[model samples]
Target: MKKIILLLTLITLVFSSMPVNEAVAKSKYKKISVSATAYNELGRTATGFDYRKHPTAKAIAVDPRVIPLGSKVYVPGYGYAIARDVGGRIKGKIIDVHFKTRKQAIKWGRKKVKIRIYRK
Candidate 1:
């Protein structure tokens, strides 16, 4: 069990470091372009994920129709995140990325970005 867990962790780390284009090639997925915004909220997410405590968790809010809930997403500059939450304003191809700090969120602001989505 421990070996399997370790192997899974190792695989996640390795895949996460892979370049965007390569990851798309390796995975059964869809690469999409969307509007991305950042947030640093101090509460539980729609998925009941305690993102405030797990500050390093790469969590994203999305419209389930576009990116299904619990899907893994790769944002170019933001690294890998899971689609775990949703917002009233987050409809269509817009995604909300969570950051550890307000400054980081502000720094990220909003941008048009291409992201790779993988079904978990």
Candidate 2:
């Protein structure tokens, strides 16, 4: 009887402590057509922070109206990034990802990709 009560109490505590949304609260993302480009860290970003010292090395310039600043995004070929910078040409669905060198940026060139914008 004591063992049964202890088991029930333990089970209740475990279930109560577990987040109800832990399994169901996955981040919802919206897919959008984006003109993807790359930029080097030679200059400062529009955010007033030096490009090289940006929190995420994978910084992306995006039109605030389209993706908003300080957003988390996922680019197909470029993996994960934060929308932290902006440029004159980076309007609408266009995005400019930062790289370490001009050669690397040039290698990326320009292309169209579907990026996922995290909604959480």
Say which candidate scores most in TM-score. Answer: 1
Model 1 TM: 0.76
What is the C-alpha RMSD, rounded to one decimal, of candidate 2? 4.3
Output the TM-score of candidate 2. 0.71
Deviating ranges (above 4 Å) for candidate 2: 1-27, 54-56
lDDT of 1 at 108: 98
What is the C-alpha lDDT profile of model 1 across 1-120, one tens digit per residue?
A: 999999999999999998789555775778999999999987898889996678799999999988999999999999988999999999999999999899999999999999999879
- Per-residue lDDT value at 34 in model 2: 86
TM-score of each: 0.76, 0.71
* Local lDDT at 103 for model 1: 95
> Which tens-of-lDDT digit does each residue in 18-106 have in candidate 2?
88683367647789998999988656666666755553478799999999888899998888988878888887989998888888889
Q: How far is candidate 1 from the true structure (C-alpha RMSD, Å)?
A: 12.7
Best by lDDT: 1
